[model samples]
Target: MEATVASLVEHGWAGTTTTAVAQRAGVSRGAQLHHYPTRAELVIAAVQYIGAARIAEIREQATDLPTGPARTAAVLDMLARVCTGPLFHAALELWTAARTDPDVRAAVVPLEAVIGRESHRLTVELLGADESRPGVREAVQQTLDLIRGLGLADLLTDDGARRRALLADWARHLDARLGS
Candidate 1:
């Protein structure tokens, strides 16, 4: 799966093949086909493997934080740490695949929905509420958009400060909007 995913990432989905993945994985093409049978199956498995890895990372980062703003900060900060590498790369490749391929889009959409729900769940938990106020969605979008934008920026730039500022700013915004 790692070899398949890396190959698909380096070469687009259309360029990757079972034979190629087998070659990269040092396995027989027959074995690869036996396992995956089709490109769509392989792509779906690759996405799932990547998403599970990401979820584990999120769980690890959130393990130490108390629920509320601290937990939210921790989650966002961890995302900041990974946004430039695998996370960003995965997002780019999958989203690009999604644009042209319905099978890929269908595979990715549910995973995205899961992440979206998880984000909202974390936000609600952080705010100590069952539901976010109207501002919560906007705050999340702004933060996610900023993180995505900055992921490609200079690595030497102050990401910690930037993430911290965003977290603080989002908290204030949510608090003001929620009247809490």
Candidate 2:
């Protein structure tokens, strides 16, 4: 699965073939085929596998964050890391492929929905933000959307400085709005 995710990140969806994943994973082609009969199946499984691992990492990191204003900064930092990281990049590859490929879309949409929901839940939980509070959920969603957009920009060029500055500014606004 690690090899599959790495392949997707490095090669994009079109280039990430089952044979490539098998080679990267050091497994026989037959063995790989046994587990995943089709490219779509392999890619879907890879996304799910990597998504699960990323979510676990987020949960683990959330446990160590301190409460207060710092928590807001920390949560934003974590979200930024997640959005700009390899897992997200790999998922982006799948999403891009899914735009035109029905098979890929069929496999990816439901899994992507699950990952999106979990990501939102994690962000809300880590911030201790009450979704019931007016505008709280919208604020959180905005934060996520901003981070994801910045992440896409990062994929295009060296935008670290801009991303950091934007995140810092957003963190302040979010802290005030959520009173975290």
Candidate 3:
């Protein structure tokens, strides 16, 4: 799965073949086929594996940050790292492939649900409030709203200064809101 995702990230789903994953993983093609009979199955499994690992990392990082501000900063930092990471790039590639690939899209649903729940939880926690709170919910929404645009921009644009500014502003906003 790790080999599959890395290949997907480096070379979009259209380019990533099971044989390549097998070669990268140093596993036999027969073994790879034994695990996944179809491209869709492999894509789905790769995505799930990547999402699980990313989520685990986030949860672990949050464990040490009980304070709202620190947690907020940490979450944002994690988001930045994820956006820049190969996993996210792979996911993005899969998303594009999902349009024509029914199986790929189906696999994405569960992963997206997990991400949504976690995003909400992280937002509420770092904001020192629950989603039930008016501004708290909005702040959480805003944080993600910004990420949606920024994620795409980060990939398409090469303006490092702008990206840095956005990240800095994001950190500042959370820092002020949490006031740790």
Estimate TM-scores for all models. Answer: 0.70, 0.94, 0.82
Q: Which residue pairs does candidate 1 place in steric collision?
A: 68-126
List clashing residue pairs in candidate 2. Answer: none
Candidate 3, residues 1-180: lDDT per residue as tens digits?
Answer: 778777887777777988788899999988888988887788778878877876666566566555534556566666666666676687788778877878888998778888878867865665565555445567767777776666777786664577667767787875555443
* CA error at residue 145 for candidate 3, angstroms: 2.6
**lDDT of candidate 1?**
0.68
Model 3 backbone overlap count: 0
- Clash count list over all predictions: 1, 0, 0
Report the lDDT of model 2 for residue 130.
92
The digit string of per-residue lDDT tens for model 1 on 97-141 reads 898889999999998888767755654554454334566566666
Q: Model 2 Cα displacement at 139 (Å)? A: 0.4
Better of 2 and 3 by lDDT: 2
Best by TM-score: 2
The models' CA-based lDDT, in order, is 0.68, 0.85, 0.72
lDDT of 2 by residue, 1-180 (tens): 889888988988778888888999999999998998887788778768877877887887677788766778889888788778888898888789889999878887887788789989989988889999889999999988998898899997878888888888888999878865
In model 1, where do residues sit more than 4 Å from their true spots? 8-15, 65-73, 126-134, 152-180
Candidate 1 differs from the real structure by a C-alpha RMSD in angstroms, to one decimal, of 3.8
